[model samples]
Target: MSSPQSRFYAARLAGTPVFDPIGESLGKIRDVVVLPQARAAARAVGFVVEVPGKKRVFLPATRVTSIMPGQVISSGVMNVRRFEKRSGEQLAIGDLLERTVTLLDGSGRATVQDVGLEQNRHHDWMVTKLYLRRIRSGSGLSKLVSRGQTLTVDQSGVKGLFGTDTEQSAALLLASYQDLKPADLADIVQELDAKRRIELAEELPDDRLADVLEELPEDTRVEVLTGLDSSRAADVLDEMDPDDAADLVQELPEQVAEQLLGLMEPEEAEDVRRLMAYDEYTAGGMMTTEPLITAPETPVAHCLAMISREEFSPSLAATVHVCRSPLETPTGKLLGIVHFQHLLRERPDRPVGEILDADRHTVEPNMPLSGVTREMATYNLVSIPVVDEDGRLLGAVTVDDVLDHVLPDDWREQDEPPATTGQIDLSEIARGIHDGDTGSEPAGTAASTTTRREGGRG
Candidate 1:
């Protein structure tokens, strides 16, 4: 029999087997669902259970007769279907565990190591507290030993969890996500509900929002863009890379696309419109208009400053196109190409024209995808400039853009393991605390703590 005081951290319950009174095995615990109400301990609603043969079903907490270390005895009733997240429901292990969060105390960020749930007098389980581990830095054994100091806080003390709370100010919330790469942040946002996703999109700055939008799938990108007001959507689109902006606008309905294009600056809109004129599979369609260019007589110092000032991507900045007069827009009369490396090795005062590689290869904007791939492969180039018959520079295609065209349509939809702080062993941390392993000190001693407010339901 389980006592009312008995408790289990979410990490300990995950993967534990469930069985019926007669000892017949039913399934394993996959996730614990709870309702996230503000200022209260969240109530455990049920378990997302994985039955044998790989089917996942929901087993309500009411059907759970007893909870123990390694097994849960249940009344055996369950709904046989895929688990879909509801508006009010949150998963303790699946959604909250290992998520990055900020402490209300103004100490820096920490990862949620585990959530503490306890059985009440009525035999109901409620989330009572949270276990946190600080972000750490080091290498080898020292890194393992000095890993984050662990602390426990009542659920009320958590100021915010990245991508989960929309009520907090955007600047505060965005600070937590800044450490995550745009692709990783996009994955987290995609898991959120439509309403939450829209809220997040509204709060992010245009540049940051553009980066995330570029990483999202075409369908999701359209949905998010459509959800925003026209002016804001146009601002975000304008901030995006021209190639990416063109691709996104092309997916929008003609009326909506035209409206957004009109809202953009003339130069920016012209760049996108020019690319849109080409077939999506052709070199012209896949190129970016932001390649580095300079006159042959331009000094190496001037070129270096342009690259640095513009913050051109590594591939685009790797080579500089040298041309005739009117250097800003290289004319079809191509002169030579200068690798960034060669420019650096020469005297800063030297003219780029003297060091240009006259034999550099170039591709036509209308070239087929296959031809582009072969040219890139043959020359082992990171970026190939696109030009017209007049040898005028149009744009450049990067290796990443090429892969995006060649990869499977569902490549972005494939499941990726959730990101986590790899420093601590969660199960071991839970067991050590439960067993009172002072010597091992899985998490550092609890310094300051806050207890849940009495009688409030989270």
Candidate 2:
């Protein structure tokens, strides 16, 4: 049995397998439910378990016998009803995770990364504190501050400083959404209605919005972009990966697309135009126009600094393309490539040209999708540079774009249920509870057991 002093993190508890005393698996925990009225030491009433077929079931916390890493032991008897949200019930994972909260000490706002829970002497689980990460703000600062230190705070601090009002909570919640991974944020957006999605998009900064938009399905992406004002939409598009931006613009009506392009800054618009000119299924269409490039004679330290200063994605940062003199746009000539690993091993003060991968492979802008995939597979490369016949660097196609092309259209829509058992009709269970037909004892009866435990511990 777990002790009253034992503590657990909400992130660690999520998806833990639950099993009966006899070793029969019930389900996996999806979310922890707490009553908001309980305030600072909110009591955790139950868990939302994910059963098979993607259905969710609610399990009262009292039914749990023991909690351990990766597993939960149950008393063998559980209500197998579908889980439904009751008024005033706050979910640790669904409601609190990723929500933003203001610090009492006047420090900048931070997003809730996780929640801390501890069992009291009464045998009741309570919310203890929150894990927070600072939000990065400003143009081109997202990637620079992508990684931040985490801080922990107790509930009393939150209520005293952050307020308990709906508007303040909602604002913080929306702000915290920026910290979520693009894929995770996209999943949440897909589950919301059009109005709510629009509301969320309005709160996100352009760069973050661009990242989330790139992860969304085509229809959802179009809907979100169309919902924003033309200028805002153009700004988001400008911030998006060039290939992704082109794909979106191609879906819009010719006039609207043209208007958006016209609104975008010339350099950004030119990049998109270059991508738009290519066949989407070809190498040119799938490549990002913003490949990291530097002059061959540039110092290694300078190259590293540039890599750190720019907001290139991890894969793009993996290799730096080397170009000859006249290093500006329409790069003088494609010289070679320098893998980041090799660059890091060399003396920082040395010129990058000393260690160029002169024999590096290259692909044409017009190469077919299959050919491009074969080339990447053949070389085991994460990114491949695209060049015109004159050996001028154009752009680079990333492996992620290739996977997106080859994967099934509905791949992103597959159901992902929390770790647990099979499904049951929740309405039937609700009816049973209403008619007093459920074989389980009333909640008050369960509370008495905990009350006794509390008295004994005290």
Stretches > 4 Å off in candidate 2:
1-172, 175-178, 325-329, 416-458
Query: Cα lDDT of model 1 overall?
Result: 0.75
Error of 1 at 164 (Å): 13
Q: List TM-score per model, in order.
A: 0.61, 0.61
Model 1, stretches more than 4 Å misplaced? 1-125, 129-173, 328-332, 416-458
Task: Enumerate clash totals for all models, in the order shown.
Answer: 5, 6
Return the lDDT, model 2, position 348: 89
Error of 1 at 388 (Å): 0.8
Q: How does residue 19 of candidate 1 score in lDDT?
A: 95
lDDT of prediction 2: 0.75
Q: Mind sharing the TM-score for model 1?
A: 0.61
